[model samples]
Target chain A: MLLYCKDLTKKFGEITAVNRLSFDVKAQEIFGIAGPNGAGKTTLYNLITGVYKGIGEINFDGSEINNLDPHRICHKGIARTFQIPQLATSLSAYHNIKIAAHFGNEKNRVDKKVIDDVIAFNGLRDKQGIVADKLSLIDKKLTMVAAAMATQPKMLMFDEPMAGLSPLEIRHLMDLFKKINEERGLTIVIIEHFMKVLTELADRLMILENGAKLCIGPPLEVTQDKRVIESYLGNCYAESK
Target chain B: MGHGGNLMKIKKDLGVLLAVYGLLALLPIFFHNNMSLMNILIISLIWAVVAGSWDLIMGFAGIFTFGQIAFLVIGGYSSVIFCKLFGISPWFGFLIGGIVAGGAGILVGLPCLKLKGAYVALVTFAVHMILEPFLKSDIGRAIGTGGAQGILTVPPLKIGSYVYNAMEPTPWFYTLLIISFIAFFIIYKVVHSMWGYSFIALRDSELFAQSVGVNAFKYKLIVFGISAALTGMIGGVYANYVGMLSTRILGLDLFLILMVMLVLGGMGRFPGALLGAFITMFISESLRYFDTYRLIIFGLLVMVLVIKMPQGIIGLIFPLGKAGIIERTILHFREKKAKKAEMIT
Candidate 1:
C-alpha cells in the first residue's frame, strides 16, 4: 500500500468533519471517492495532505505520517490540487509551475527539463506566459495539475477537479488524469461529484455520507449498494443506472 | 521565461541601478559648497535604504510590518549605547546594532507567523507603540538610554584617522552613497533569487504554497530578519552622521514621510523607492517657505497623485507597453504638427 489511514477523524468544535475513516490505497491504482456536499470528502484530502491535524494514524509507505506539516508531507512525495485551483494569480503560469518544481522536490536544484516536460504534457506550453488570473478556467486547472505533477509525487490527490468545467473540458481532464496515472505510474485518489466520471475512470470507488463511509467496492457494485443509493446516489441515479 | 532570460533581466536591472548611483556620485562635485543641499542628499540616501527595505518586506514578501521605525530607533540607540559603554569604534557599534535589531526582528516575527494581513499590521504596529514607553522607562535609563533627554554625544564614524562629520559633507555623502549602494545590491539579489519566488508563492496562498513544499513561516521570518538588518544598519549610520539620538525620531512625522516615499515610488517595483526618496526629499526641501502649510500641501498632493496614478511614478514612466507617458506625449505633438504641415502642403 502506498497510503494507509486508520480511524482518521477531524472535528471543528462540536461538528465532526471526518469521522473514523479507514482506507488504504495500493500503488498505481486510481481510487475514487464520491459524496454529497459537506460529507467530509475534502476533509479527508486535508487530513492526508497534513493541512489539518486530526486524530488517528496515517501511514505512507511504511512509516507513520501523522502530525507532519504540509511541506514535509509534500517532500515525502504526496501532492494535491485544490477545488478552487489555488495559484499565485499575479505570476505567469510558467512561474507558478516553476515554484513547485523548485521547492516541491527534495533536490535543492530545479530541473528545467522537468518543468518544460510537465508544461508540455499538460498542454499549457501555449498559455504558460500568461498570468494565472487571466487564464481560462480549464487552463487554470491544467496549470494547477502541471504544478502538482512537477513535484514528482508518489501519490496525487484531486479535490473535485471537474468542478466548474464544461462537459467537453471535463472529458479532456479525464483523459489527462488517465495519462498521468498510466504514463507516470503514480497512485491517484480523486474526489469527484460526477458518478459517470468515477464509474468510468476509477479502479475502485468509495461512497461517503455524513463524514463516514457509506460503502466501498467496485464502482458498479458500490453504486448498486442499497445504502449508498439511499444515502448518496438517490433513487433517480439508481433508476438511471 | 527560462532561467537564462531571468539572468539577463537581472543583469540589465543591475546596470540601470549602477547608472543611477553613478549620477548621484557626480553630484558632490557640483554641490560641494552648498551645505544644505548636501545634507538633503545625504539624508535622502539613508532613507532610501530604509524605504527600499520596507518595500522588500511589505510589497514583495507581502508581510505588512509597520515596525520599521521601531527597528530604526532600536539600531540607533543600541549603536550609541554600545559605543559609549564599551568605548569601541562606531564601526563595530554599527555591526552590533544590526545584529541586535535582527534578533528583535526574529522575536517579533515569531508571534506574527500565525497572523494574517491586517492582524500582522496591528501586531507590528503595537511593537512601534510600545517602544517609546519602553525606552523612557527606568530600565531604559539604567541601560544608558539617557531617559527623557536622550543620547546627546554620539561619536562620528572614523576610517583610518579620517573623521566623517557634517562640517565636511562630501566625505560623509560618498560614504553613505557606498553603503546605500551595497544595501540596494543585496535587495536586488534577494528579489531575483529563488527565495524571492517562494515568498511570492507563500504570499499568494499559504496553504497551497505549503502543499507545494514552501515553508511559509521560515520564508517570512527570514525576510523579516533580512529587512530589519538592512534598515538597522542604515539607522546606525544615521545616528553617527547626526551625532545624536532621541525619541523624537520615533515621531509619526518621519514615519509618514517614509511611507510617502513608498507610495510615490511604486511599491513592489525595484529601484522605485530610491527615486521616490530623492524626489520626495527635494519637494519637502523646496516647500520649506510654506512652514506649517507645507504638510497640508504635501498631504493634498499625495491624494491627487494616488488617485491620478495609482501605480505611482514608476508605473507612469515605464508602463508595461512600449510607450510611457513622456513618449506618448511627444508622439501626440509630432502627429499634430504633421497634420498641420499636411494641410499647408
Candidate 2:
C-alpha cells in the first residue's frame, strides 16, 4: 500500500467528524470517494495531508506521517488542493508557481523551466502575468492545481475539483486527470459528488454515509450496494434512473 | 529568457542608490561650517538606522515589534555604563552594546514569536514598559545610571590620537553617514535574499507558506534578533554622539517619531526608510522656530499624509506601476496637447 489510514478518528467538540475509518490505497491507483453533504469527505483529506490531526496512524510510503507538519508531509510526497482554491491572490500566477517550486523542489536550486512548464501544462500561459485574485474561478482552480503539481508529489489529492466547473470544463479536467495518472504515474485520491464522473475515472470507490464507511469495492459494485442505495442514493435517485 | 533584462533593472536601481549615497557623502563638505545644519543631519542619520531596523522586522518580515526602543535603551545604557564605570573606550562600547541588545532580542523573541500578530506586539510592548521603570528605579540610580536626569558627560569616539568634538562636527557627520549607510546596506541585502522571500511568503499566507515548507517561527525569530542588534548598534552610537545616556532614548515620543519617519517614507521599501527619516527629521527641525505649535503642525501633516498618500514619499516617485501626482500631471498635459492636435486636425 502506498497510503494507509488505520482506524483514524476525529471529533470536533461533541461531534465526531471521522469515525474509525480505515483504508488503503495502492501505488499509482486512482481512488474515488463519494458521499452525501456533511459526510466528512473533506475532513478525511484534511487528516491525510496533516492539516487536521486524527486519533489513528496515517502511514505514507512506509513511514508513519501522522505527526508531520503540512510542509513536511508535502516534502514527503503528498500534495493536496483545497475545496475552495487557496492561493497568494495578490501575486501573479507565474509568481505563485515560483513560490511553490521553491518550497517543493528537493534540491536547493529552483528551476525556472519547471515553473514555466507547470504554467504551460495548466494552460495558463496567457494569464501568467495576471494576479490570482483577478483570475476567473476556473482559472484560479487551474493555477492552484498547477501549483500543487509544482511540488512534485507522488500522491495528489483533490477535494471536489469539479464542484463549480461547467460540463465542458469538467471534461477537460477529466482528460487532464487521466493524463496525470497514466503519464506521470501519480496516485490520486478524489472526493467528488458527481457519481457518473467517478464511475468513469476511479477503479475502486468508497461510500460514506455520515462519518462512517457504508461500502467499499469496485465502482459498479459499490454504487449498486443496497445500503448505499437506500441511505444515500435514495428512492428518487433510484426511480429516476 | 528575460533574465538579462531583470539584471539590468537591478543594476540600474543600484546605480540610482549609489548616486543618492554619493550626494549625501558630499553633504558634510557643503555644511562644514554650519553647526546646526550638520547636527540635524547627524541626528537624522542616527534615526535612519533605528527606523530602518524597525522596518526590517515589522515592514519586511511582518513581525509587529514595540520593543525596538527597549533594544535602544539596552544599547545606550550598556555602552555608557561600561565606558563610565569600567573605563572602557566608547569604540568598544559599540560592539558590547549591539551584542547585549541582540542577546536580549533572542531572549524576548524566542518565546514571543510563538505568539502571532497583536500578541507579539503586546509582548514587545511589555518589554518597553518593563525596561522604562527598571531604568528609573533605585537599583539603576545606585549604579550611577543617572535615572531620569541621565548621564551628563561621556568620552567621545577617538581614532588613534584625535578625539571628535563639537568644534569638529565634520568628522562626526562623516562617521555617522558611513555607519548609517553600512547598516542600511546590510538590511537591503537581507531584504532581497531567499530568507527575505520566505519571510514575505509567510507574511502573505502562513498556512499556504507552511504547506510549501517555510518555517514561520524560525524566520520571525531571526528577523527580530537581527533587527534588534541593528537598532542597538545605532543606539550605542547615538549615546556616544550626544555624550550622554538617558531614559528618553527609550521614551514613547522617540518611538512615535521613528514610526512616523518610516510611515512618511513608505514601509517595506529599503530606500523609503532613508528618505522618510531625512525628510521628516528635516521638516521637524526646520519648524522648530514654531516652538510650542510645531508638534501640532507636525501631527496635522502626518494625518494628511496618512490619509492622502499612505505609501509615503517613495510611493510618490515610484508607485509600483500605479499612477502618482507627477504621472497624473503629465497625463493632464498630454490630454491638453491631444486636444490642440484634434483642433488642428
Candidate 3:
C-alpha cells in the first residue's frame, strides 16, 4: 500500500465532515472515491494531504504522515489537485510547474527541464508562457495536472478532475490520467462524482455518505452493492440491477 | 515558429522597458537642479522601493497588506534608537532595525495567514495604526525618535572617502537611485524565479497551492518576512536621507500612498511600481505649485487615474494588451495538433 487511511475522522466544531473511515490504497492503483456533495470527499483529501487535522492514522508508504505539514507530505512524494483549477493566474504555465519543481528533486530541480517536460506532457508548449488566468478551462486543468506531475510524486490524489470539463475534455483528461498511471507508474486516487467516468478509469472504488463509508471494493462490486446504491440514491433495493 | 514567438515577446516587452528606463536616467539632468524636484525624485524612489516590496506580496503573491509603513517606523525608530542610545554605528543599526521591523511584520503576518482576501489588508492597517502612539511616547522619544519633536543630526555612515552625509543632496538622490535599482532588481529576479511562482500559486488559489505541495502558511510567512525586511531597509534609507525620525502618523499614510501608487501604476509589475511612485510624487509635488487648488487637483488626479487609467501609466504607454501573442500562438498550435490527431486517428 502506498497510502492508508485507518479509521479517519474529522469534525468542524460539532459537524463531523469525515466519519471514521478506513481504507488501504495499494501502490500503483487508481483508487476512486465517490460521494454526494458535502459527503466529505474534499475533507478526506484535505485530511490526508495535511490541509486540516483529522483523527485517524494516515500512513503514506509505511510511515505515519497524519501530523505532517502539507509541504512535508509533499516532500514524501504525495500530491493532489483541487476540484477547481487553482493556478497562479499571474504566472506562465511553465513557471507554475517550476514552483513544484523547486521542491521536486535535486536531479529534476532544473526548472527549464521540468517546465519543458510538463509542457510536453500536457501538450502545452505553445501556451507555456501564457498567464494561467487567461487559460481556458481545459488548459487550466492541464496546468494543474502538469504542476502535480512536476512534483514527481509517488501517488497523486485528485478532487473531481472532471467537474466543469465538457465530455470531450473529460475524455482527454481520462486518457492523460491513464498515460500518467501506466507510463509514469504513478499511483492515482481520485474523488469524482461521475459514475461512468469512475467505472471506466478506477481500478477500485469506495462509496461514502454524510462522512460515513457505505462500502468499499472492486469497482463492479461497490457499484452493485445495495447499500452503496441506497447511499447514493435515497433507498436500497434488494435486487441487483 | 517557437523561435519567432519568443523573438516577438522580447521585442514587445524589453524594448519598451529599456526606453522608459533610459528616460528616467535623463530626468534628473533636465530638472534644472531644482531641490524640490530632487526631493521628489528621492521620495518617489523610496516610495518605489516600498511599492516594489508591496507588489512582491500584493501584486505577485496576492497578499494585500497595508501595514508596510509600520515596518518603516520600526526600521527608522529602531535604527535611530540603537544608534543614539546603544552608540551603535548607523550602518549596523540599519541592519538591526530592518531585522526588528521584519520580525514584527512576521508576527502580524501570522494572523493574516489564516485570513483570505481583504482581511489581510484590514488587519495590516490595524497593525500600522496600533503601532503609532507607542512610537510617539516619551520612552520612544527618549530612544532618539525625539517624540513629536523628532530627531536630528544622526551622522551618516561612511565608507572610506565617501561620507554619506554630504550636504549637496546629490548623494541622497544617488542613494535613492542605487537602493531602488538594487531593490527592483531583487524583486525582478524573485518574480522571475520558481519561488516567485510559489508566491503566485498561493496568491491565485491558496487551496490549489495546498493541493500542489505548497505549504501556504509557511510561504506566506516567508513573504511577509522578506517584504517587511525590504520595507524596513527602505525606511532606513528614508530616515538617513533626512538624518532624523519624524511622526508615526505618516506610517499608515505612506502605506496607503504606496498602495495607491501600485494600483495607479500596474499591480504585479516591476517597473510599474517605480513608475507609479514617480508619477504620484511628481503630480503631488507639482500640485504644490497651484497652492490653492493643489490639494483639489491632486484629488482629481487620483480620481481620474483610478477611474480612467486603472492599470496606471505603464498601461497607457505600452501596448501591453497585445502581449497576448503567446495565447494566439498557442491557439495556432492547437489547430495544427488537432489536424495531426485527425490524420493519425
Candidate 4:
C-alpha cells in the first residue's frame, strides 16, 4: 500500500469532523474521494499530511507517521494541496517552485536542471516570472501543483482541485493531471466536486457523507451505490433521461 | 557556473556595505555639533538593527509585531538594574537583558504560533499592558530604575580605544552601522537558506507549509527568539544613548514610530523596512524645525504613505523587490555551474 489510515478521527469541542475513518490505497493508483461539504474529506487529507491533530494511525510506505511535524511528513515523501490554492503571493511562479524544491532536495541537490524540469513539467515556463497573487485562478492552481511537484513526492493529494475553474480550464487541468499520473506514475489522491474530473482520472473511488464512508470501489460501482446516490450524488445526476 | 563571477558579486556587495559604513564613521569629524549628529547616527544604527531584525520575523517570516518595544524595555531596564544596584557593568547586563527579552519573546510567540493574524496582534497588546505597569510600580521604581524618575548617567558602549559619549556621535554612529551590517548579513544568509523558504512558505498557508514539512511552531519560536534578542540588545544600547532611563519618555513615541516606519516602508518587505526607517528619520528630522508639532507632522507623513501607497511608498517604486530576490538565486546558480564546466572542459 502507498498510504493507509486506521481509525482516524477528529473533533472540535462537541462536534466530530472525521469519525474513526479508515482506508487503504495502492501504489501508483489515482484514488478519488467524493462527499458532501463537511463530510471530512479535506480533513482526511489534512490528517495524512500532519496538518491536523487526530486520533488515528497513518502509515506511509509501511512506517507509522502520526505525530511527525508537517515538514517531516513532506520529508517522508508525501505532499498535498489545499481546496483553496495557497501559493506565496509575493513569490514569482518559478521561485515558488524553487522554494518547494529546496525542501525535498538535500543540500547542493537542486540546480538549474532540477528547477527547469519541474517548470517544464507543470507547464509554468511562461508564467514563471509572474508573482503568484497576480495569476488567474487557473494559473494559481497550476502554481500550487507546480510547487507540490517541486517536492517530487511519491504521493500528492488534491483537495477540490477543480474548484472555481472554467470549463476550458478544467479540461486543461484534467489533461495535466492525467499526464502526471500516467507519465510519472505518481500516486494521486483527490477530493473533488467535479464528478466528471474524478471519474475520468481516478482508478478507484470512495464516497462519503456525514464523515462516514458510504462505499469504496471502482468509479462505476461507487457512484452507482444507492447510498451514495441518495446521500451525495443526486438521483438526477447520471440520468435526466 | 563560474566561481570567479559569483565570488566577485559577493565581494562587491560587501565592499559597498563597508564603504557606506566607512563614510558614516567619518561624519563626526566634520560636524561642529557632534553631539546631535552622533546621537542621530547611533539611534539610527540601533533602529536599523532592531528594524532589520523586526523585518526577519515580520517581513520574511510574515508575522506582524507590535510587542517589539516591550521586548526592548525588558532588555534595557532588567539589565540596567543588575548594573546600578549590584555594581555589574551594563555590558553584562545587556547580555542578561537579551536573554531575558528573547526568552520572553519565545514564551509569548509559542502561544501565538497557534493564534495567527489579528489574534497575534491582540496578544502583543496584552503583553505591553502587563509589562508597562510592572515597570512603573514600586517593585520596578524601587530597584533604582527610580520608578517614573528613570535611571541617570549610565556608562556607554565601549570596546578597546573607542569610547561612545556625548561628544562622540560620529564614533557611536559608526559602531551602530557596523552592528547593523553584521545583523543584516546574518539575516540575508538566513532568508536565502532552506529554512528561509520554509518561513515564506508557512506564511502563505499553515496547512500548505505543514504539508511541505516545515514545523510552523518551532520555526515561529526561532524567529521570535532571534527578534527578541536583537531588539533587547538594541534597547540596552539605546538606554545609554539617552544617559537616563524613563520608560515612558524614551519608549512611548519611538515604539509607535517604529511601527509607522515598518508599515510606511513595507509590512513584510525587506528593502521596504530600510526605506521606511530612512523615510521616517528624514521626515522627522526635516520637521525638527517645526518643534512640538514635528511629531504631529511625522504622524501625518506616515498617514500619507499608508493612504496613498498601502504597500508602502517604496512599494510603488519597487513592488518586485520582495519577489526579485529569486533572480539573485538563479544568477548565483548559473555562475557556479559555469565555473564547474570550465574546470572540467
Best by DockQ: 1
Q: Candidate 1 on A1-241: residue-level lDDT in tens?
A: 9999999999999999998999889999999999889999998999899999999999998888998999989989999999998998767788888889988976747999999999999998778877788789999999889999888889999999999999999999999999999999989999999999999999999888888888888999999999988888899999987
Candidate 4 local lDDT, A36-78, one digit each (tens)? 9989898788788877779989999989999777788888888
Model 2 / residue B240 / CA error / Å: 2.0
DockQ of each: 0.53, 0.40, 0.41, 0.31
Per-residue alpha-carbon lDDT of model 3 for A1-241, expressed as tens digits? 8887888999999999999898889999899999888999999988998889889899989899987878778878888888877777766676677777775553435566766787798898877777777788889888888988888789998889899889999999999999999999999999998887888899999888899888888888887777777668444332423
lDDT of 1 by residue, B9-45 (tens): 4686687689889999999999999999999999999
TM-score of chain B of each: 0.91, 0.88, 0.82, 0.80
DockQ of 1: 0.53
Report residue B21 deviation for candidate 4 (angstroms): 5.2
Report chain A TM-scores, every model: 0.98, 0.96, 0.94, 0.96
Better of 1 and 3 by lDDT: 1
- Top model by lDDT, which number? 1
Question: By the TM-score metric, which is better: model 2 or model 4?
Answer: 2
Candidate 2: Cα lDDT at B105:
91
**Which pairs of residues collide in model 1?**
none
Comparing 2 and 3 on DockQ, the stronger one: 3
Candidate 2: regions farther than 4 A off = A34-37, A105-107, A129-136, A163-169, A193-197, A225-241, B1-16, B80-92, B138-153, B286-307, B321-345
Candidate 3 CA-lDDT value: 0.77
- What lDDT score goes with residue A101 in model 4? 77
Sort the predicted structures by lDDT, highest score first: 1, 2, 3, 4
